[model samples]
Target: MIDETPVLDDHLHLDPDHHRGIDAVRDFARLGGTHLLVVNKPSWHLGVEAESGEDFREVFERTIDIVDEASSELEGRAWPVLGVHPGLVSRLVDDRDFAPEEARDLMQAGIDVAAEYVAAGEALALKSGRPHYEVDDAVWDASNAVMRRAFEHGADLECAVQLHAEASEDMTAVATWAEEAGMPAHKVVKHYASGRLEGPTPSVMCDKERLETAVERGELFLMETDYIDDPDRPGAVLGPKTVPRRVRWLLENGHDEAVRNAHVETPKRVYGIDTEATLDRTE
Candidate 1:
C-alpha cells in the first residue's frame, strides 16, 4: 500500500511459548512491514540461568526458528539478532550473588556463543549493551567490558550490534569502545533511540514526532517498535504493527525518501542484506 518500500523493524521479540510467535509476524506484515530483526530475549527470560556459553544456544536457536518460520510462512522476512542482554550482569550480581567479575565472565561467554551463531551465518547481527538502570562502579565496569567483547565479535563478523541502552546513557561515549574493538561506530546500532544520535546508528523508536525531526535533519536511522509479544503486557513498549503503521504515516505525509532511507538504505548498510535479496533467498 505504501509503494512497497519494505518497512523493517530494527528491534523485535517473539514469544513462542505463549503461542504468539508467528502470529506477531503476521500482524507486522498485515500492516505493510516486510522484514524485522528478531532479537533473542535474555536467557533468564527463557527460564534458564545460562551456566555456560553453550547455554545461550537455546536462545539463539529459538530465535532462528522464529526467523525460519516467519520466512517460510510468507509472513515477511525475519533475521536473528542474537547476544546476551547486558542486564544479565545485574541479575547475576544481585540475584545470583555472583561477583561482578564472575557476572562479566559469564556474559562474555554468552557473547562468544552468539558470535559463533553469527560466524555460522545463522544470525545477522549481535545485541549488547550495559545495564540501563543504576549500577555501582564494579558492575558498570564489568558490563562495559562485556559490551566491548560483543563489539569485537561484530568487528570480526562484519555485522551490526544492536545496543540496548537509554538515550540518556552511553550514546556518545560508546564510539570509543567500538573503535577499540575494531568495529566502526556506525556498525553499532542504538536501540530505543529518538532524534539525532551522535555516534552509532539510531534505531529510532516508532514515534512520529521524533521521526519527523530525524527526517528533517536527514539523519540515517532505522525504525523499530521494540515489540515484546506478551499477552499480559500487550503493547507495552509497542505493538508489532507499530513500525509499518508509522511508515504509512510517513508516506501519507510525503516523507517517502525518509522511509526508504530508514527501512532499506540503512538496513542494507548495516546488515548487508535487504528485502528483495532476502526474499529471493527464502523463495
Candidate 2:
C-alpha cells in the first residue's frame, strides 16, 4: 500500500489545543494518508481578537508549527496554508463593533501578513472567501474586497487560494475573478465544494456518492475531508481518515484512474508539488 499513489487531503484543519492534533494525524497516516495541507483555523476559535494584522501572526505561526510537528515524528508530509478568514468581516462589524470599511481594512491587512508567509515559502496557499452564509450588501462588498486581496496575493506568489464561499450558488464569476487577478482558475480552489458551485478545479469532499458524481463528470478534481478537528464535534464535516479510506474504496471498486488523477495528478497541476516524488525520493 505504501508503494501505491499517495493520498492527499487538500484542506484538513488540525486544532491541537482542543482536538488531539498529532494523534489525529497519526490516525490519517495509519490509514494510508501521505500528505495533508494543514489549514489555519479561524482566529476566533483560538480566542484571538485580531484587532490588527499582526494579531493573526500567532495563528499563522501555530499553523506552521502544526506542519513542523507532524513532519518531525511522522512519515506523512504537511504544508501550512495561512490567511484571514472572510467571515472575520462580519464578526468585526456585528460582534466587534467595527465599521464595514474598517473591517475590510483589517481583513485586508491580515491577508497581507498571510501573503508574507506564502512569499517566504513557509505556507503553500492562502484561504479566503466571503462568508458561507448570507450577508447584507455592505458586508458582502467588504468580504469580496478581502477575497480579491487573497486572489491578488495568490497571483503574486503563484500559489493556490482555497475559497470558502457560499456553496449553494454558482461560482462562475469567482473563477473569472481569479483569471482577472492573473491567477489561473485551477489554482483558485473551491474548498468543501458540493457537486455544484465548483471552479475549474473543484476540491470535492471525500464522500462516496459525491465522489462518484465528480468522477463521472470526468474533470480534474481534488478531494478533501474538510476535517474541522474539533474535540466536541469530532468529525462534523468528515472524519480524519476519510480521504485515504475513500481512495481505498475507489481502488477496490475499480476506480484506479480516478485515484491517480485526484490524488496525484490534479494536485500536481494545481500546486506544482509532486506528492509522489516528495514522498518517494526527497529527504
Candidate 3:
C-alpha cells in the first residue's frame, strides 16, 4: 500500500536553543520524513528594546538567512511561507500606545518598520483574550502589504495564514474578509482556541458553514490542534494527540485532497515550479 501519510507539513517551529546555527538545520533536513513549509513570525515586547525592534519582517528574514546559509551548506531540504502573522499586529503597535492620529501617521509612513520587525527573528508572544480580538485597520493594512511582498517575491515560498473563530458573526466577517483578501489558492491552517478538535472553548469554535465556504473557494484549510494542548500551559490538552486526530479526520472526510490541490498544486502552477523539488534544492 502506498504510504497515505501527508508528505508535507504546513507549519512547524524549529527549536531555537538547539538549532542555533545552520549546521543543525542541515542535519535536521537530511533526517526529514516530512517536508516542512515553516511560517516565521517574530516579535519582541513593548517598553523593551528587542536587541532588534519588535516587527515580524526582521525576525523572519533573520531566520531565513540562517536557513539560506544552512541550505547552501546542506542543499534544499526545507522551504518557507513568509508573512507577518496577524496576531502580532497589536503587539507591534502597543509600544507606541499611539494616539489615533499618531497611529495613522505611523501607518502612512510605509510598512517597512513592520517588515523590519519580522526580519528580526523573534517569536510572537500572544496573550489570552476573552472571545475575540479586533484587528486594527492600520495594522491590517500594514500586514497585508507585507503579505503582498511575500506573495510577489515568488521565491521558494507559499503563503500561510491562520484563523480562530469565537463568535459566529465575527467569524462570518473574517471569512468574508479572507475571501476578499486573495485567500484563494493559499495554504491556511485553522487552530481552535483551546487548541483541541473537540470541545473547543467558545473563543475558538468557528461556524462550520463559513469555514466550509472558504475551503470550497479554494483556500487550503487544515485543522491544527497541537497548540491547544501546549505543555507549557497546565491543563491545556483536553484531547489526546489532537493535531494528528484532526488531520486524520479531515483526511477521511475528503477535505485533504481539496486542500492539497489548493495549497500544493495551485501554488506549483502559479510559481511555475514544483515546491517539493525546490525544497529538495534546500541548500
Candidate 4:
C-alpha cells in the first residue's frame, strides 16, 4: 500500500441495494484510515424490466433518503455525492416492451412526482426487498432533469457522476452535457468494462491522460475504483496505497506538482473539510 495518507478517496459507492446501513461503511473507512465520498445510484435491475406497475419515483425518493441518513451520520467524516448513471439513462429512453408514448408520458409524470416526493423528505429509495427498473431512456432524461433541479435547490452538496459511454464520441457528448450544465465534467468519473460486468486495466483508454487533459481544461478529475474487473476495459483503480505511488510517478515524470496537488485539494474544498490535513497527520 502507498504509505502516504490520501486527502480523500475520491470515489465510493454505498448503495443500500448492494449493502445495508452505515456501520459497514464506518468500519471500512476507520480500518483503512481513509475518508470517502459515498456515492449513490438509483437502483435499476434487469429483472424488473418486464414488470408492470413499476415506478421510478420511488427509486429517487429512496436514494435521497439513504443519502440524507448517510450525510447526517457521517457528517464531516464522509460526503454524499449523488448521480444518475448514463447506462440507466440510456435504458430509460430506449423503447422497450412498454409503449413508447406511454413510457415517455409516465417518465415525465414521474419527475413531477419525484420533485414533490423530494420536498416531502422522500429523497431516499431504500425500501428493503423491492426491485427497480433497468437502465433506459426515460431514466436518462429523468435523471438529467432531476440533477438540474437538484442544483436549483442549492443543497450545498457536490456529488460525482459516472458515465458509461462506449466510445470517445459518446464520452465527448456526455462531457458536453456536463459542461453545459456547469456540472464537474472532470469530476464526473467514468467506469470502464467490456459491457457492464467486467473490470478495467490501469492503461485503458485515456486513463491518466484524460485526467491530465481535464485538469488542463479546468475540469475536475478524480481517480475512482469500482467492483469487478474487465480485461478489455480500464479502471483508475490505483487503490489507497497506489494513489500516492501514482502521485510520485506524476511528480517524477515532470508533471506540474501544483496541478497534481489540486486533484485532492479541490475535492476537499467542495466537501468542506481538510481531508488532506488528516492524511498529513497519519503520515
Top-lDDT candidate index: 2
Model 3 quality (TM-score): 0.47
For model 3, state the Cα shift of residue 204 in Å: 13
**What is the Cα-based TM-score of model 4?**
0.48
Q: Please provide, for model 4 over 169-276, each residue's C-alpha lDDT reduced to its tens digit, 9 standing for 90 to 100.
A: 234444455456565444344443121111111112224655455435443344444421222233434333333344445555665543334345555443334655
Model 3 Cα RMSD, 1 decimal = 8.8
Better of 1 and 2 by lDDT: 2
Per-model TM-score, in order, reads 0.95, 0.95, 0.47, 0.48
- Could you give candidate 2's per-residue lDDT for residues 91-171 as a string of tens digits? 899998998889999999999999999899899899999998989998999999999999998888999998888875368
Question: What is the clash count for each candidate, in the order shown?
Answer: 0, 0, 27, 32
Candidate 1 matches the true fold with a TM-score of 0.95
Candidate 2 residue spans exceeding 4 A from truth: 1-3, 196-198, 280-283
lDDT of each: 0.84, 0.85, 0.36, 0.40
- Residue-by-residue lDDT tens digits, candidate 1, 1-283: 2475777888989875774888888888777778888899778878778878888888889879878888664435788999999889888999999999998888999999999989998899999898888889999999999989999998888889999875653366897789888888888999998868888988888888878878987978899989887777774898888888899889989899898898778888888886655553332
Judge candidate 3 at residue 100 and give its lDDT: 41
**Which RMSD values do the candidates have, in order?**
2.0, 1.8, 8.8, 8.7
For model 1, what is the alpha-carbon lDDT of residue 17?
78
